[model samples]
Target chain A: MFKVGITSLCLSVLLVTSINASTSGKLLLSGGVNQVEGSAGGGLTPWAFIGGYGTEDEIGANAFITNVKSSDYNMVSTGFVVGFYNRFEFSFAHQSFDTRDVGATLGLGQGYELKQNVFGAKVRLFGDGILEQGNLFPQISFGLQYKKHEQGRVVKSYGAKDDSGIDFYLNATKVILSESLLMNLTLRATKANQIGIMGFGGDRKNNYELMPEFSIGYLFTRKFIAGFEYRFKPNNLGVATEDDWLDVFGTYAFNKNFALTIAYAYLGNIVLKDKQSSLYTSLQVGF
Target chain B: MFKKYTVCLLLLISCASTDKLSTYHDFGEKKGIEKVVDDLFVYLLKDERTKESFQRLNLDKTKEGLSNFICVTLEGPCKYEGQSMKRAHKGQEITERQFYGMVENMQKAMNKNNIPQRAQNKLLGKLAAMHKDIIGN
Candidate 1:
């Protein structure tokens, strides 16, 4: 039932967003791609750009579906993003993570799935990465994400503090057009365990902690971009050691309305498993 | 966290590569710039992207002024001091889309003239910084 609703919603958005490219908005590549947390950015870091083509006057939107497969698990995410006047953004994502063999090892049945819903909002604060061109003022933004992780009992049994939480972040992005390079620095405060898949907080550390995320991208051409992202994670749970996340991704924008990305992700450790390297892919439609 | 800060500092330092534009003078000399100016005008006149903006302009005079302006901007021998972008674009509420259209046509012209991406981006960098002054209400 949930899948059907999301499918219809995605289809409706795709149908409605074929709107003409005649609006006053950014170019095809300016908006960036959707991150894991339903923000416009690289795979792991949320940059300062308000997602989509919306200018200071026009409204624009984007939708994304992502799949990630690792040695011990597989996950799928679907999200919708709305950019208002290129100044503020609202986004929603539903993520389902399947623990293939690992679930059975943890005394759960095989192929157990953990579900999460994330809602986020971001506001651009200052600077223009592109228009400023060579200047030093990077684009900056502030954002927050509320995450609800289902299966609270399962997480609490493992000594988690909460099943839901909010994440706050600030991102600074700069695009050096002459060299075709883009960079992002983000500071995030959170108490989530395994990015809220294993639930939020823990008995070991029940307070919010600060971590840094980094992303760097290079545009090989107007239509293609290659990038890397690293997200730092805090160790809070005695359930299993959590590792930092890293990914290298490449995106190709077919046009203003369609884009695709492929990536290699390293999650480090999870639930007695170590060094979980995986393949990640996402398909996005934006206008 | 300290490692992250160090890496960010390195990236910030690298962002100051603005001086790179001044070093590549051999790519387009005064003679080459004259031809580029001509080709740019031709492309603007014929290219579908920016042809609309060039329709009402005087091509010959535009060619001379643009050529001289670029020559001096690139530290070449020619001397051309045109009106500021705001003054020249006054009364015309040029959109950013139209500005980019013109830049794309110029890029095609530069590509055809074999002006390398480094030099091409250098030129576009200077022009892009004039976005606010050129695009107005």
Candidate 2:
């Protein structure tokens, strides 16, 4: 509890500092949809979709909502992000995982659910679009995330606890074909914490795992863009092991002030043992 | 496959190394305003500010237009359909010093390109006619 309080305080301070550092100029707003397949990292089953909006340039702010579905469970998540000087960004997300009819079969009655919260911060050490030429490398950013989980007693009986841990990652992005094509490659590492709803286990030693991701996009015109992303993660949960996923997406800019994105993901099941797949979609809007 | 990929890669690499415009275009035609403008560009490259401005321009298209404009202005066999100097440069706040610096650079570029002084003077005379519109009092 005290740890959570301290984390919240740190996030507040960081946000305040970033806001003050922002120089008044022009502001840009953007939004997009993201989908995830398979049980990437945590054990929340193999399905989910995320939608979000962001304001950027000197200062930044973003908000998102996510939903995941499985044979016996379902989860919904909401997240927020803010940044300053385009150098540092902070984010917060909360998730609710529900154990449907399976809860009754397990003698816990129906409508049981688990909840998890995540807080993250990212800082850019080098790279800028305005400062660098086309021949130079793109921007790189380093980030950290802390997650905590909680659940109802019936769900807790399955050995769930309020677990907390940290994760770190590095991301690189570039606009290779300026006005036509854009590409991004991200490499991330995180301590194996429980999947969002499942608490981090007390027995396993916290280990760093690499999560590499790639995205390629083409802008058909100033108003439309299509892209895809692939991500890899480790199986941290004992319930079901998961594999990587591929996401295909498209975005349309309504005008200078509004845009929308949609995506479909093919999840590759969990535990490498069972082959389960799912689809995900998201909608985003921004100034 | 490796050989094919290597050949493609070399093609792209060579394309990257090639200049955006040919030297002949930079030097302008053998006799006319194209020659004069080429001279001016060479001269302008010497001054830091004018050079910076020139570098900022989209070199390929701008150079083409300049070549034609100079030829037409020098009584050569060409018509310049682009915007006049004054109308084109309005709101840019270009100063007399900057203009003169540009002219001197043009002279130098002509000399470097082997254009004779007589031809340089002939082109300069026509360039002078647009000063009123370009400088705007």
| Top DockQ prediction, candidate number | 1
Ten contiguous residues with the weakest lDDT in model 1 chain A: A16-25
In the range B33-108, model 2's lDDT, one tens digit per residue, is 4555655666666666478668778766777788777665544556678887877788776654455556556656
The candidate 2 chain A region of ten consecutive residues with least summed lDDT is A40-49
**lDDT string, candidate 2, A1-287, tens digits:** 32443364356445645554332222111122322211111112111101122212244343334455544455566555555545565667676656677567656578556566777666666764222333437666666667776553432344433366566666665544323445666666754433444454322334667777777776554356677877675555555555676667666755322334555655565322244343343322221
Supply DockQ values for each candidate. 0.37, 0.03
A1-287, model 1: which lDDT tens digit per residue? Answer: 23753585578455746554443357667888888878888877788998887776667778888888888888888887889887999998888889888889888889889889999999999988777786868999999989999899998898888989999999999888767788999999999998899898887898999999999998776678998999999889987889999999999988767789999999999887889998998877875
lDDT (C-alpha) at residue A197 in model 1: 91
- Per-model TM values vs. the true structure: 0.85, 0.53
Docking class of 1: acceptable
